[model samples]
Target chain A: MSKISRRKFLAGSVAGGAAVMMTPAKKALAAGSFEGFPDGMGVLVDFTRCVGCRTCEAACNKEQNLPAPAKPFDDYSVFDEIHHGQPRRPTSKAYTVVNRYETKEEGPVFRKIQCNHCNEPACLTSCFVNAYTKTPEGAVIYNSKVCVGCRNCMIACPFHIPGYTYESVINPVIKKCIFCYDTRLKEGRPPACVESCPQQVMTFGKRAELMNIAHERMRKNPEKYVDHIYGEKEVGGTGWFYISGVPFEELGFDTHLPKEPIINNVKDFLAVVPMVLAIWPALFTGFHLLATKGKSHGHGDDHSHGEEGH
Target chain B: MKKLATYGIKPHDAEVKADGQKWSLMEKLLLGLTLDQYLDQLKRNKFNWLLALIFAIGIPVIIYRFIFGLGVVTHASYDYPWGLFLGFGLFCMVPLSASGFMLGTTVEIFGRHDFEPIERLALLNGLLGYFFAVVYLLVDLGQPWRLIYPMFVSWGPAAVLFLVGWHVATYLSVQVMEVSTAFFEWIGFPRGYEFIRKGTVGLTVSGIILSTLHQGALGALFTYAPGKVHPLWYSSSFQWIHYFTSSIPAGLCMVISVSTIVILTMKWRCDDRFINNLDRITLSLAKGAAMGLITYLFIKLLAVAHDNEWAYIATGWGAWWLFEMLAGVLLPMFLLAVGIHNKNVLLCRIGAFVTVFGILLNRLNTALITFNWQLYQEIPHMWEIVISITIFAIYVATYRFILNRLPILYQYKAQAVEEGVAVEAEQKAAVNA
Candidate 1:
């Protein structure tokens, strides 16, 4: 073959290689179901076994070095405390809180609330500064150093998990549970909260394994536990799954949250952002050229026309 | 010599003293009035006193907020992370400022030269609105000084707010360039003005692109809270489109409203050209706004149908939504249509005001009122309200400051004459060389 034809063949091969590399990545984004790391650890909480002992809450506070709470952890009276007609939730001072729900079927049910560390965490996706990172160990952690403190993550989190230290006049940042990534989880141990549970309420292992254990528990005790495992499909699955005797909704869980990832709601707009960026310049510029085609030479007359009404 | 109204300072006329000395910058700032006349004007206006009182009460509170923390001024509920500063200041102001791109597209892209008189005003309006929106964001952000982290230090490419941050920053610069031509002329820099004028089409096109994405992105921001925002207000698929489409009318009506205010209160500042064409332009803008409202109304209904949220309209929140539609969307549409049909400038101005108010209501609803519908309602703390008003007052003051000096409402004829003289002088120098 001639030198020119050989060069053409080489160029075509390079272009084809580039095309092959690009297609699958784009397809992955379009598919949009990220199940996270295969061996990522998760916690399976059996709410039926919880005694509302507040051990997990105390353990989280101790492990996270959160500020002293208004009331001591052993004080059961704290459960009755309500603000704005809502039960106590995790605040900046406390990374986890247990709330007691008086259900019709069950006398009392306790649900421990903290960051679910979702497979596609909304807080991670919504943060503009990339402050958040979902670790391979299934811990969603945030870097306060990069946080602009926009609190957009607070707005975006489906679980309303991230809390801000608004009272700090200097250097306020988001405060939330990191699933004990720094202390225990990174070392292949369960979180302080999970380990501290007296009744072995939470079983910690690989997420896929935990899902199986949760289902197996439900299968063995069909009447004692709900047939469904919370967080298995909630917000595209979460690191923390819950099985309860009472309905999840009765315990203030947002049951209506879409099974798909929260970022799915924003994908339509994200898809259009590039399209507008790509199309609008050429589109409007073309209009400008067409509108002023022959008038370019007579641009001075355009000013005269502007002056006519004066 | 007959005293000229504030608007009567023609470009060619030397604003000089009786001694023929040029007016100093201070004298220009005083609106060409003697110290006594300026003071007299200030005292005579009760509105000025009211503004003064607001500043006195609110400015200190704003300072206190910075010193103490957001918790002092705002309720600072973690459940309600955003307050009036963002809900009202950022969201409402950005859409209202959309006038810049809309008018720029009309004149520069479509060649609607008749709209040229108001184009600078619209551009200035856009620039100031976005500028102050950032100001509000700064005040609201906990680490306001670290704002550039999103741009330079950290990159969150997947986030919608990341797109918003980059786009708003870029669009603000684009608007600055578009508005700077008038500033160049006002400052007697004909060459600078000419340079900017050459890039008008490119600037306008970029403005359109940036405005479209960011405006829609603002709505898409709410899509993250699908269960939080009321179903009537939230449609996963159409939220961005709703926000973008509604911004068209919101922006156009703002221009109409601002221009009307200019014609009424700043008549002395307006040239004969602006004065003569104000009513016609207002009507034309009203027509555009009406069309935008119609389309907005249709798409809103379509969204409800698509989401199967028709059942939501009968509840109390539904009633509130109906009121927003009727007063903000439907009523303004009807008024604008009637005003345009009959050429009633007064009616059109009223419609524009109503439309602007409606847009504000919609933004407030989406960002605050309807936000966290399942939770308790949050009324802004008194100091928060006060600070919001104070910031808005500053925005208005800045806007007026620019308008009172720049050749925004009037053409700068002196710059034109200066350009002609410079060309002749250059030609002579070339011949000599």
Candidate 2:
């Protein structure tokens, strides 16, 4: 190659490198528009239909092979049980629980609490070991083998669903509802809890159809239901949504959560990570050269400031 | 000839002892003291007794945490997943350890050779702080053995912790290389020292890059939970910058504080060069820290304003935030300004202490205290607190061990003075030839 061509090629390469560095790798994909897989299934819970029977809880316990609860699922007294001034949520032994919240207008309303199984799950994104996976079947499943037990997922979860087997010394792992993915959902059947709901409180179907059904129900009985579909846009939409007669906040829901996915908050930092990696080396090296120029020639007086011993 | 005592003995320029024998590596490790003198020094200190008492009670609990599980030592509440181990250890230690890169940049990158006296001490402080932070992480991790899983077994490059894990591991090596020049010189390995000296610029640049990301990334880890952390503490856009910016002051103040402790407690080990220049360096460090504090204060307020969270200031958490800012940032900034203006080394040292305390408070607030603001507060178990203190004691012991033996607080004699002259002469002769 000619000398001029070689110079042009080098210049071109440097410019190209600089251009690549200047542009962000890619703008982080925005989160709200995502509405899960086309055929992904979901459960639509109608709060007015639930009777606080705890039958779904029992079904989940049996299907997941979880240990027996402190009080039997048949005990109605368990509804009043409270610990630390808060109603009991899910534990390692229970994948789903029903909490009763009394509203002034609506009377006693029972909300079945479980993992929402978000379209873009915070637990999946925050995990360093790739332990949590959002299966195509719309279930957020976990592989305990790869879990490092950092409990970051538990912290990231907005629903506070994930629990840890912290008491197990030998092999502790995250415990959460998997939507019966292994035995039911992957086999094209509904979860055990959905199947066991005798009051027909939950309607399981394709998530898109379920959305239509929820909105239809709200439209048909505007006075009976609140004007909102909980989880439709909360934390970028969850597979399990609800239409309640009362406000979700009164039902112990964090209604103030962002409509965007949890990962949106992290994108700002993630974007800067690569820029620092690529730019800082050259930038600081240039500073070093600029700072040390002309002083490198004489290593004795210029470099050393004449401390007696040195 | 009298045998050297361990506590107050200083390394001198002389190659040979009064007995006409050269100092062996073992004797150097012993601080040129006889075995009896070293043992006597260990027994004589009351601080050692306190450390011993802590270890006696704390060590078994830490062991119990591993054998019985984290639930035994910690509250094991899933709501507050990270207790003191990470809230205090990983989050707090990483920022304080920022001294390594800060000092490295000042000396090698900025050509401020005057700050060279405490540069090695700063680097050692950084290395040990990061090293122990990882120790805390190991204790906190459920499957601590699977730590390598992030590096090799599975890759979660998109996760913020993946960045922290990678940067901290890489930076630790960079620090080892930067500080190894001292190790090589003290061990009389001229080749190793020369090789490292040639790569000083490369090492320092990489150190800056790694420290910047991981320090910021530590704060970004909380960005994953925008709802959980209080609005005052959580700003997605500014969280990383807040952490990265405050780290500058935290790093600088940590060095000043560590230097102050060294000067007060181990004056005999420091040479005239270190002792004479300490006050000036402390003042200079205070100036840098003051500037960093002002910038940090502005950005923190900027975040509050950006989030439109001024209304929260009237709440209980808002009051706590104000205390952290006033006591941790503003108070130290005022003290440092006064110290710098009046050339009061004592006041600068006090400011440094406050700044260090403030950084610790901020990290604890973000990770533990203000986390899950609506949820019930989780006070860490007594056993968890005991384990955290015990690990810190071990960190202190290791730090003292290295400072006493290595050419950190004092310069190594042979290469620093005589060989430096010889090398300069050779260079001059080559230029003239």
lDDT against true structure, model 1: 0.82
Each candidate's interface RMSD = 8.9, 6.4
lDDT tens digits, residue span A181-212, model 2:
99999998999999999999999988989999
User: Which candidate comes out best when scored by DockQ?
Assistant: 2
TM-score of each model, paired residue for residue: 0.91, 0.92
| DockQ of prediction 1 | 0.34
**Angstrom error at residue A173, model 2:** 0.4
TM-score of the A chain in candidate 1?
0.87
Please report, as a residue range, the 10-residue window in candidate 2 chain B with the lowest summed lDDT.
Answer: B1-10
Q: What is model 1's C-alpha RMSD? A: 8.4
Model 1, residue B198: distance off in Å is 0.8
- Provide the interface RMSD of candidate 1 in angstroms, 1 decimal place: 8.9
- Candidate 2 per-residue C-alpha lDDT over B1-433 given as tens digits, one digit per residue, 9 for 90 to 100: 0123222233433345544566788877777655665666667667789999999999999999999999899888978899999999999999999999998889877878789889999999999999999999999998899988877887666677877887788788888888887787566676787666655666777788778888999999999898899999999999999999999999999999999888877776787789999999999999999999999999999999998999999999999999999999999999999999999999999999999999999999999999988877888999999999999999998998888777788766532233233443443343333
Q: Please give, for residues B175-240, the per-residue lDDT of candidate 1 as tens digits.
A: 888888777655556678666665566667777877888899899999999889999999899999
